[model samples]
Target: MMANPNYASLKELARAKRAQYGVTTEALNLIVVRKIYSDEGIRIDNWEFPRTIRAAYMSDDADPSVAINKTLPREPRLFSLVHELKHHYVDRPKIEQGQIKCGDYNENQTIEIGAEVFAAEFIYPETEFLERLQLLNIEPGQCSPEDVVRLKRECRACVSYQFLRKRLVRLGFAMPHAFDKIQFQKLEEQLYGPPIYKQKWFQRRRGRAQAK
Candidate 1:
């Protein structure tokens, strides 16, 4: 996979943003993004959208805006909002005149990669996140999913395990094969519990089905 071209700069930006919010520890809250939106004259709105689409951006040049799908869970909503904000702050030159829609920006493999990159780096600053990983004391190619989950909890960040695993490899703390998402997920369940997002979504679907 091609690396994010803007990785270094985005990491710095995320760190600065985190510091600006007085985020000494714990998760970098979505409210920090909202503060940027306020400063940049951007507006936020919630709208219903298809399951595949998580967020959208409309750049008026003077006052840009973002819309997050109302149905998304808390983690996805925060990440999606950051992704759209990336479009607003970094990729404004690339965005088309009026609007652009993002369907799970991470999976959109073309022009939107920069936004996804920004969100990942912003959510997990490289140096601080790596320091957290170091405390795990796990060797290369030996990391289990439970370790990543614990680190996520420690960081108080809502990022996915897959992202953490990739960061591990990216930073050379772990080898490429060390982070298997599927195996990690299984170990995660055994250690922690079933994924909350899937559990909630499944319950909601079942309720809707019963209602119908």
Candidate 2:
């Protein structure tokens, strides 16, 4: 009768969706949330949403149509939708049950991050994205917001930071966290610069590396 607060519930929801729709989790994200929640008949209570940006919300009951806060960017919008779905199954009414306390969550809560990561990786496998980026000669150290956006546009990647971070992690690439990531900046700067020409350099070095 109560909703599950743990983000794991979302993962189960995601896994089930991927299996049913034949789409990767990332690709299935807010889109899936939008579809399933709507089919269930849940609608967002608009008055509860913030003013600046249209925040995504879900109605707890079977009235499944998702009320997307239109102003939120596509990435966060999708994440919020999933977060709201989590609320539908886990958060609401529990305040009375003492499962989750009121005002316990801020806009920047970490569980939202987890849900987004769940959605992103399912869409773009870290290994697959990195290998493809490398194959495109786009190094991780050489990535930026623009590069991220470009990659998402070109590869249809889910637009979330940790998703990109995971890909770089798998590729043994490090991102500068304290300040702006220079790698991405470099890529942005070089966008119109003379191209990088790597003529079979790896091919010549591959045999020795592979043999060792």
Candidate 3:
């Protein structure tokens, strides 16, 4: 596949690869990425990358590897890993030949964007995302930041708010950057309270006691 491949083509390729790997939508929703890497025999290295570089793919005939930024939150790390998988599949030859670099966003814009498209589709198909929005009664051009936060909480897909925002913009559910200024994370915490892990110790203890 050439650089700047169309979105449809990239989506098809991603779904095909998912099938080949026996990765179901449920698995993707849960972010079972490391298992995929292990199954593919791709080595994973969690290293500290510069802020601008989220991950890199290194292709080798015997052992392909991906280095991800260790500091990235769970969702972005999962996205980056899948992004490198695109390079491993379609851009390996170019990467190995030094014609393309996987992590450099400044160069190889076409391939980088293509990888992003592939990653997004692989992580959560557009059709499924649309269906989810419909199930939640979220309409095009009328989605609110709070609706997005609820979507994140209710949807099984492990995606960042930025991911949801971009999808909304692409699907005409919202204008570009409409949610950029909104701190979805903070809002989520405000609305839903902190995630279970961050809840107060007494709250956790109470929950555990209630569970028994």
Candidate 4:
């Protein structure tokens, strides 16, 4: 069994999907129509799970069904939908036999991690997303956290602020540590609405750094 997923290959898989579907953005319709699962006749539906389990795709006795937690916000729900679809790419046999459980989907396990990467890149194709950012006047090495916020709202793209930040770093739009103390605090507040512990920690850190 492979210990880690081939990220490059998975990226190529996403690229291939883009080329095949003639879509510049994520082809969610493929998953909806069961085409992305290839010839498999998996059905998509909404089944509310516990808060932790956002989605599940089961292939039991050759009966495949994908259930999504509809309570999730738009971005997370979309990501989880893709994450479950990625299981078909990661382990076909296990998925076919109902041996795989994507419960701990957020964990660092190889399959889970691969699914996360697949979902993110699938939703925001790197080149097209970069072009979208560029159209917003946000260029590589020139974008700020504020620019990302504006883009998120303008594009109406479903992605977390953290994901947006990482995407910016990946695309060379910002340095790894580009958002400083104040900026990071502002971003956190904007996304999550004033985290208690993080607020105190950032305050102390900002004070000490400013004193320096």
Candidate 5:
């Protein structure tokens, strides 16, 4: 019999969902994240924070349902949930024995970046995100807030549009050299800046060096 799947393999999960279930990559994304997170004792929500939260809880098993804070923007929430998902990505029940403290800053910084990558790839499939955006007649130039609202709604992305746009760039679908062509140089004026990743490249590289 095949072994039960773990969160360790995003590539595998994506492939399986495609070959086995015939699900779209996006839907496979949701399935993989939900499966990995649920096993790790993290609660996946439908409408709560929309992103996620991962504080150091004092238990072997986490609470079944995490609070859904609707007030926060979806970008932060997605980042948060993605963060928690990474905790499991490392080691689930074994790590949860409190052998490793859950949600420590050092640990969080280590794990969250990968989760962000996973989430970004999942939410913004390189081929799909670019095509979808093209269909909307939208480029990343700072559209009016009204346009932002309309574009996001059209994409069914109620979360942060700019945030997703930046994620697209990181995933290599966005044309960074053509940020001006996308008209973002002018539009990015509204938001303070690009979407932030959890751990920086420098820190990640430093850690990898140490590990090696």
Candidate 6:
């Protein structure tokens, strides 16, 4: 029987894969998931998957593919893509033999957790995250919701606040579920106004009104 990989091993594997794919920290900040998929020859289809199913991967030797939930926002979609990539790399054989399954993570807890670890590390490595926090002078137990917003704004990684919060908790930087009830999007908007697209749309509307 194969030994189940622990978190540290999974993280190392993820980092190695990142290196193999030439994924640098700068690339991660720019969100290279789709580029990585193209490089790996994995086809992507955005479908309206069930809410419970964020994404699914099929390791078909002839044509490997990943189907992601179209309704997921940008950050989640990127994360899910990387999550499926993990399965593509490590769980392909088990998946092919029907020894593992997707969607329902509970059935394959260890593998699923490993995939999560891989995705997280691949997207935003812990060392970089810690470095960013330290640069910002954020200490353990000192991160506030506002600080989290700042982190997201400054970090440049395409990840949700939930992802950041969970990472903080996992690294003992913050208490678990400490920011669960905070509506991060709402807070972000309140702090920085609307997102760039919305600002652009509003500017366009004003320009049209002035011309009229």
Q: Summing lDDT over every window of 10 consecutive residues in candidate 4, give the lowest-scoring window.
A: 24-33
lDDT of model number 6: 0.84
Of candidates 3 and 1, the better by TM-score = 3
lDDT of 5 by residue, 29-68 (tens): 3445456556556665444323444332223444534333
| Models, CA RMSD each | 6.0, 13.3, 3.9, 11.2, 15.5, 3.5
Candidate 6 lDDT by residue in tens digits, 13-112: 8899889878876556324777778888989988887788888888665578998888988878878888888888888888877676655555787778
Q: Model 5, poorest ten-residue lDDT window? A: 49-58
What TM-score does structure 2 among the candidates reach? 0.53
- Once fitted onto the true fold, the runs of candidate 2 whose alpha carbons sit more than 4 angstroms away are 1-13, 24-32, 45-68, 89-98, 101-103, 107-110, 122-128, 137-150, 158-172, 178-212
lDDT of 2 by residue, 1-212 (tens): 34345555566665565566576534655666557656656764443346544444333343333455566666666656655655554445653354544334445466455545455544554556766687666764665456564664466655556446555654545465612443643454466443233336666677678899
Global lDDT scores for all candidate models: 0.69, 0.54, 0.84, 0.68, 0.48, 0.84
Q: C-alpha displacement of 61 in model 6, angstroms? A: 5.2
Candidates' TM-scores? 0.71, 0.53, 0.87, 0.65, 0.46, 0.86
Ranked by lDDT from best down, the candidates are 3, 6, 1, 4, 2, 5
Separate clash counts for every candidate: 0, 22, 0, 0, 8, 0
Error of 6 at 209 (Å): 10
Task: Please identify which of the two predictions, 2 or 4, would achieve the higher TM-score against the true structure.
Answer: 4
Residue-wise lDDT of candidate 4 within 1-212, one digit each (tens)? 44345876777776676566564453354344246554556677877778877887777776677888878776677677777767765665776654655454344377777777777777777766777886899877988777876776666455766677777886689888775443654664687577664577888998899999
Better of 4 and 5 by lDDT: 4
Give stretches of model 4 more than 4 Å off: 1-5, 26-40, 97-99, 102-108, 137-142, 156-162, 169-212
